[model samples]
Target: MAPRSSRGKSIRQRGARPPQPRAVSAQDLGKLQGLAGLSLRKLEALRARMRIRQFSRHSTIYKEGDESDDAVYIVLSGIARLVCLNRKGKRNLLEVLGPGDVIEIPSLLPDIHHKLTCETFTDCQIGLISPTALVEGIVGIPFREFNEALNLTVGRWWTLLERHSNFLSQTVREKIMLALLDLGRKFGRRDEHAMIVDLGLSGQDLADLVESSRPKVSECLKSLVAEGVVKREHRRFIIDSVRIQTSLRS
Candidate 1:
């Protein structure tokens, strides 16, 4: 096996950790998808039972082969990337999760070790709920509403699967175009001639997300800029929706 690079400090550090219970709020609980319909009392109860924590940029949330424990996580803000390393030490990005997404739920049932590592791409707040609490809450909730929540969570996973498939099959140019479109649909704002993606991912990071080499990504981006399909700011890309869409079709 290849040796792991010593890049950053261990996630568990000395000194008193921040008080999680006091940090949680009803408003924060409301931001999570499955818990939206939950009452304030319920939220408070859950908060007391869970560990609500904050992590800075590039912090490792969990590592592969770590005990799964009985915990699941909900993103409160910012983004995180799930990644896996192959036997050859090649890194593969599994998915990028934003606020309201849950992590590590599937591993909770069998209580197996984590299969992938989760790392923060930006500063983020997260809530950790014990598997017992989660199961109890689900059992207490109405069957219809629980089913609806399950469906929504499954749909989110399906979207991630489609994105991963696209990254595997598409060329760098096609991937960039599709990424721009997806970002525009999710969080874009309109300009005079284009939709601006406000996500602050760096060029190299974007290349990793699309499973492409940085030089190839840069070449494609430059071509797009020259063709007026995308305009680059310092880090963000402002994409001409019509041109980007047309390029993808062709």
Candidate 2:
């Protein structure tokens, strides 16, 4: 047998264990947009009941129809994809969410389950809020304000759905262009030359987002390259906003 390493022997002698993750704190709850500007007492009360969890990239957070009558999940960092699986087993991408976005709406209501499956698009940190805390007025925020915020999130999803439904009557290239524009608004960063979209999505994923085939999406991307509306940079896309808008208008 090979000789045992001195460091391994020392660690064994000390009976050491790997470090544990830090506990979720009141400040962490404040990071959630809905919870921001909350009174200190309310924040502390809610924080006491909150749980923090980390999910690896591509891992399923929850699936459609899964029971979620317990707590609400808020993303603290990284991106997540909400998708639906049809009877034919084809997956449609519903929305992509980043930090401070709530993962689901149905999860907040009583006796309801998740309507869409949520999966981490990147390694994510999430906070879980107890439904009882909110319902019992422990947080002390106005119910109407909370409900309005929730409704606004749902409204955005509905708008996206309606837009994509209308895309059925449009050309595949137009659909791809519009999808990129929307994605750029959500996840793009401004540079000296153009907006850079770094969502780390694959061609198949983009196809699912726009309700198109991978081959068609690829061809449309080539067309876009020809038009100088967008250029590929590794996994990201560099977009010329003015050109895209002009092309869309014409």
Candidate number of the best TM-score: 1
Which digits, one per residue and each the tens of the lDDT, describe model 2 over residues 35-105?
A: 67777777787667667777766566666454543567777776666665544454555556666677535
Off by more than 4 A, model 1? 1-22, 32-42, 85-89, 109-114, 138-195, 199-214, 224-229, 239-250
Question: Which pairs of residues collide in candidate 2?
Answer: none
Compared with the true structure, the alpha-carbon lDDT of candidate 1 equals: 0.66
Per-residue lDDT of model 1, residues 67-149, tens digit only: 64446887777666676554445455555667766785443433322246787755678888765676566446654455456
Error of 2 at 156 (Å): 14
Q: If candidate 2 were superposed on the true structure by all CA atoms, what would the RMSD be?
A: 10.6
Misplaced by over 4 Å in model 2 are 1-46, 85-89, 109-114, 135-187, 198-217, 240-250
Consecutive 10-residue window with the lowest summed lDDT within model 2 = 6-15
- TM-scores for all predictions: 0.61, 0.59
